[model samples]
Target: METVAQRQIHSLLAKYGESHLNHTNELIHFICIPAIVFSFLGMIWALHPLAAIAVTVVSLLYYFRLSVPFALGMLLMSGAMLWMLSVLSQDQVLKVSLAVFVVAWIGQFIGHKIEGKKPSFFDDLRFLLIGPLFVLSFLYRRFHIAY
Candidate 1:
C-alpha cells in the first residue's frame, strides 16, 4: 500500500516521465536549493530571520499531506539555509548562491514544461514543498533511510 507521499511522487513521476530526473542530478538539487535560498535571503529585505521562520512554518503547514520523510527534508534544508546565510558573507556568497538557485529552478520549470504538464504545486501550493522533497527522496533511498 502506497503512503500518501508515495502516491504524490508517483503521480508526478508518471506525468513527468521518470527520465526527467537522473538520480544523481536530483540529489544535487537536494543539496543545492537550500544554499541558494540562504544566499538569496542575504540580499533581500524580506529575507529577515522572522520572514524565514514564517516561510518555513507556512510551507510546512501546507505540507501536512506529505510525510515525515518529506517534512524532515524540508526542515533540514531550511535550517541549512539559515545557517549558511548567517555564516557566509552577504556580498559574495549571496550573489553566487542566488544565481545557482535561479538556474536550478529554471531547469525545474523547463523539465515540467517539456512534460507539457503544469507543476503540481501550481495546482496546490503545498506541492511546492514537495518539489524539493522529491529530490531528497533519491538521497534517502541512496542512504537506505526509507524516505
Candidate 2:
C-alpha cells in the first residue's frame, strides 16, 4: 500500500511531468535544472556561507518530509555544490553564479516555449522545489531504486 507521503510525491511528480512532455524540454531541463540549483546556492554562498548552509539544511528537511531517498540524493548533490562554491573567491562566486543563473533561466524559458506550456511552478509555488525531485526521480528509475 502506498503511504500518504508516497502518494503525495507521486501526484506532484505526475503534475510536474505534464508540462515536461517534450523531448527537447526534458533534455533542456536535465541540464538546466542542476545548473540553476547550483548557481542559486552559489549566489547565497557569496552572501554568506552559513546562509547557504542553512538553505540547504532547510531544503533537505523539506525533501526528507516528502521522500527520504530524494532527501539523501539532494544532500549529496548540495554537499558537492557547497564544496565547489568553496573553490571560488567570494567575489567571483557571485559573478559566476549571477551569469549562470540568468543563462539557465533563459534556457528554461526557451524550453517552455518549445514545450508550449507554462512551468508548473506558475500554478503552485511548491512546484519550484518539486522540479529538482522530478529530475532526480528519473535517475532513481534508471538505477531501479525505489523512491
Instruction: Give the top-scoring candidate (lDDT).
Output: 2
TM-score of each: 0.62, 0.98
Candidate 2's clash total is 0
Each prediction's RMSD over C-alphas, in Å, is: 4.3, 0.6
Model 2 per-residue lDDT tens digits across residues 64-140: 99999999999999999999999988889999999999999999999999999999999999998998998999999
Ten-residue stretch with the least lDDT total in model 1: 13-22
**Among these predicted structures, which one has the highest TM-score?**
2
On a 0 to 100 scale, what is the lDDT of residue 3 in model 2? 91
| Candidate 1 ranges beyond 4 A from true positions | 1-46, 90-97, 106-127
Q: Give the per-residue lDDT digits (tens) of candidate 1, residues 4-72.
A: 777876676444334334554444445554544554554441345566677667766655455666677
lDDT, candidates in the order shown: 0.59, 0.95
